[model samples]
Each structure stands twice: as C-alpha cells, then as structure tokens.
Target: MAVTDKSVLYQHGTLSLLVPGLFEGTMTIGELLQHGNSGIGTVQDFNGEMVILDGHAYQVVETGEVHELTAEQSVPFATVHFDDPKVTTHETKLTKADVEQKLLTDYPYKNVFYAVKIRGIFSHMLTRVVQKQEKPYPNLTESTKTQPKFKQENVEGTLIGYYAPELFQGVAVAGYHVHFLSNDHSIGGHVLDYTLAEGDVSIQPFASLQQHFPLEDPAFLKEDFNYAGMSTSINKAEK
Candidate 1:
C-alpha cells in the first residue's frame, strides 16, 4: 500500500490524494478518533462524490463507474480546534487533539455539537434544514448567524456529518437542528453525485440530479437520522 508518485491513484470526487492501505471510503470521526492508527489519503471525486483514500475511493455510484483524477498534488486535511467562534476563518492553527480537549471540557458527555437554525420553509414541508450543507437552493445561509445555540466554544471542529433534529426538536419537519456526525472532525471536502429516485418523500422530485458536498466534521451522524428518516426529497429541482 505504499504510495508512489507514479501510483496514479483513483479518487471519489474531483480532489483527493492517493492513500495506501486505508479503505472503506468514509469513517465517523468517533470511529477514527478511537483508532488513530488508520492511514489517510487525499480526497477525490469518482463518478459521484466520495472521500478518497489511498488507492480506493469510499463511495457507491448508483451506476457502476470509478473515476481517477489526472492532476497530482497532495491534499491536506487539518484537524483543527476552535477556541474562538465558528465564523468564516479557514486560516487557523489547531490539531485534532486540541479540538478533543475543548469538547471534553465543554459539551455534555464529551459529545460534539453544532448550533443550527432552520430559516427556510419552516412550519411546513419545505422548511429548509441546513446542517453540514445548506438547504433550500435559493437561501443558502446559516440560520444561527447572530446567535447559535451550540456556541462556538461549546463544540469542536467543523461539522462533517448529518442530523435528524427529531432527537432534540419535536418532529414536525420545521426549523433547523444540529446533526452529529462523528467527533473525528478530521474529514473535509467531499463531492458526491446523486441521481433521481422513483418515490422520494421530500418536497420535490429529482429525476437526474447531482450534488457536490463536503463533510467537514469528523463526528458520526446522529442515529435519529437512521437513513430512512434522513432521506428526504430535497427541492433539488431549484438547483
């Protein structure tokens, strides 16, 4: 699994490096946190968006196709800790350890969290819920712009997972709620291509759809989302 310059590794999306031994494509921050021995590679895009590692990209294409990137450069994934606030500051110096300590002393049970707000289509089927990714194609904004429940200091690392707020907020399909990925907060910058389905429960119906997204947090997704619960038909048509 040694990486060589001539390896010509394959990736999940557009950007990623060639990993050596690590596979599985995706891991919850908590999972990787517990096992730090795991090796990591650059993120890349295949036919769909996926986290690329070593030689293999971690993802599943509804159609069967794996894409390898032509450009060659090392992609860096920083495990940062924010003692300040979660604002637009990409330039910082912090490691995974620093963020972990902040969470242990802050958030309850030493769990990580994100203060979120739902500002789109609330009190109805279209309520936009922006978690790791913004919702409501038109209004891609942070609802907790002014005041975030999960204060910047309370949590650690950027969010990279999804949440189904039914755990914290009542299930009326309204407002925004923080979804927990894993506590890893290590994974970032992933792109995935999505296709349409026959019967989706959400607002719109997507026939041929593709979405480019990133999983910035290292935490594992909240169980409340439970796959079926989290799978909602986004009004992707607007996009």
Candidate 2:
C-alpha cells in the first residue's frame, strides 16, 4: 500500500507520557470524537476499558459490563484513526500472536501505524479490565496488578487494535496494542490472549500522524514525567 496524507493517526496523550503524577483524563469523549471513528483507549481513573467503533465510544467496566459514554467522560490515553481500511475476510484458526504476526508479515510496514479490526468467533479468549483508581494514582505498571481478568469460550467479537512503529517506543506500545469487544457487548476489555476459531482481519496503514496534548490540565503542565524504565513499565502494563 502506498503511504499518503489521506490516512492519519490521531492520538491523545501517551503511554507513560505522565509518570510522576498520572493525569486522570485530559480530553473529553466529545473532544476525541472529532479525531476519528475507530480505535481503543482507557477511561478516566483507569476505571474500565474503552473501545470505539463506528464513531461511538463504549466503556467496559471491571464487572464486564459495557456502557456508552455519556456526559463529559474522558480518557488519559487513546489512539484513533479515521478508518476505511482495505477489507479482507478469511476463515482460519489463529492465536493472538498469530494474528499480529500475520498482519505484520503480510503488510511488512514497520514505520507506519495500522488501524486493525478483526471480527470473529473465538474458541477461547482471555481479557483483562483495569480497575478504577483513587487520587494519587500509581504508575501504569503497578495499576495493572489489580486488573480483573476473564476467560470466555465460543465467544464472538471484534478486536480493535493498532500496530505502531518500534520508533515510537515511549509514545506508544511499539507493537500490537489490542482490545476486544464481544458480539453480545456484555463482555469485552483489553485483550491479553485468545484463540480465534474463525474471523476476518482488516488492516489500514497510515503514513501520517496528528497528536493532541493536554496542556490545560495543571498536572500535565507541572509533572516532571520521569522516563526512566518507561520501556519496562509499558511492556508490563500492556501484557
């Protein structure tokens, strides 16, 4: 696929972008909506999981319930793109790693970001939702220790994710960062691992990026944001 400005990655905040004191959320749901129609992110207080598809944002709480964002809900971190990816559908057996490997191998574009959407019925799926945190929040790696995990069988859902360039290390996960939303909408969260019995995977590569930083928040402006060991912290938090 040829790279073009028509495809742009719109991102808000950064992974471990705020280290000393994590800002709860700097951008509201309404504000994020203007950027793109599809992507994944975490909600304020790290209370639950967020998956945006088809221009609507849905919050999946720790209890495994999915809710649509209302009022001025916000997020400290999110990645979205105006997705209209080239579509390809196939029936095959694959694991989470297999899906990622296949995409990278087929596309083989390491420098650009790809908006990925995979829908299928899973033979096995494992997912985790981060717990809500109180003020004086801990770093992301520490916060994941309390994340509630669930396993489901014979489930159908869509996997929303992105493949980021390794060059964007501290800024993004640098690899596959994916979240899951089940067909029933009752069960979904940050994907840990899964076995897809059958599914369709679509990929759209973006040659450009547009980032929005939250400067209005006092904490964002004041925090020193120690970057020491950020690579280790992000690896632990994502897995």
Candidate 3:
C-alpha cells in the first residue's frame, strides 16, 4: 500500500513564502520540467495560474486566457511528478467534500503526499484566478479577497493538485490544494469548489519529496516571513 513507489514529487520553492506574498521566482518552467511531468503552481509576480499535465506546461492569466508556457517563463512555486497513478472510476456524482472523504476512506494513509487528478463532467465548477501583483504584493489572503471567480456548468475538465500531511503544514498546505483545466484548454483556474457528475479519480501517492529553493534570489533571501495566524490565513485563502 505504498503510494508513489515509483516516483518522486519534485517541488520548487516553498508554499509558506508564496502565501505571504513572495511572488519572485527562483526557478524557470524549463528547470521545473527537468524534475516531473505533472503538477500545479503560480507564475512570477503572482501574475497568473500554472498547470503541468502530461509533460506539458500551461499558464492561465487574469484575462481568462490559457497560454502554452515557454521554457524561459519563471515559476514562483510548483509541484511536479512523473504521474503513473493508481486510479478508480466513478459513475456516481460527488461533491468536492465527498471526493475528499472518499479518498480518505479508500486510501486511508497519512504522512505522505498524494497527487489527485479527477477527470469528468462537472455539474458546477467554481474557480478563482488571482491578478498579477505589483511590488509589495499583498499577502495571499488579502490578494485572493478581490480575485475574480468563475462559475461554469457541464464543464469537462481535470482537477490537478496535491494532498500533504500535517507535518508539512507550514511548508505546504496540509490538505487538498487543487486546480482545474478543461479538456478544451479554454477554461481553468484555481479550484475553489466543484461537483463532479461522472469521472475518474487518479491518486498517486508519493512516499518521498524533494524541495528546491532559490538561495540566490535577493527577495527570497531578505523577506522576513511572518507566520502569525498563518493557519487562519491559509484556511481563508483556500476557499
């Protein structure tokens, strides 16, 4: 029952700093690809969203457009892995919460990382996209407060994200953090909530993780990250 027996999750940067408004990136999309084929993350300056699926990289900007990313593009934070998941198909409908519960009920393993990919038609998909921030960017909670939200129906897409254990809480979000990409590649964003009509849920559990940080970046080096009430901030930001 060891998940990710064959793959390692290659992560760049730290989620804690990004949450607190460190939009500067230490790694390029090209460099990130050297590690894994699939994952999710944000672009430099918090300009837009990022999705890596099937060894390809994509960017979803504030303009509601999806662009194929170039190697030179910078990434502030991302999680990627060579995905060969253990999957299960479901014909029944399920809410976001229900999906989480089902994952726990079946897998039931703690203290590991899981790459969650759900593909199907969604009855309702509620998503949010953060705008690019200027210098002195606001923290994640404040930045997301004014984000634009989209509501779509009968949308076919894949939900991409990761589930981390409590031990990595401050370093990574402890629970599910997923993003969405439509099959047509026209509609996608950070998933706030959704209901799946029917689809397949592919779960890849990674027993090991590798973190890469940008030690040379001045911003990453100088920022005095304040974690006070970070739990509350993360909870508010996730929704």
Clashes of each: 36, 0, 0
Task: Tell me the tens digit of each residue's lDDT in model 3 across 1-239.
Answer: 21333468878887887777988767888888878878898998887788898878888888778898888988888888887887766756899999888887889656688889998999999888888998888888877778787778999988999999988876778888899999887788899889999898888888688877878888888888877888777777765
TM match of model 2 to true structure: 0.93
In model 1, which regions exceed 4 Å deviation? 1-47, 55-59, 68-110, 113-239
State how far residue 70 of model 1 sits from its true place (Å).
4.7
Model 2 alpha-carbon miss at residue 184, Å: 0.7
Could you estimate the TM-score for every candidate?
A: 0.18, 0.93, 0.93
Candidate 1 is scored at a TM of 0.18
Off by over 4 Å in 2: 1-6, 18-21
For candidate 1, write residues 3-42 as lDDT tens digits: 2211121111111110111112342332322222112222
RMSD of each: 20.6, 3.1, 3.0
- Per-residue error at 44 for model 3, in Å? 0.6
lDDT against the true structure, each candidate:
0.21, 0.82, 0.83
The lDDT-based order of candidates, best leading, equals 3, 2, 1
The model with the greater lDDT, 1 or 2, is: 2
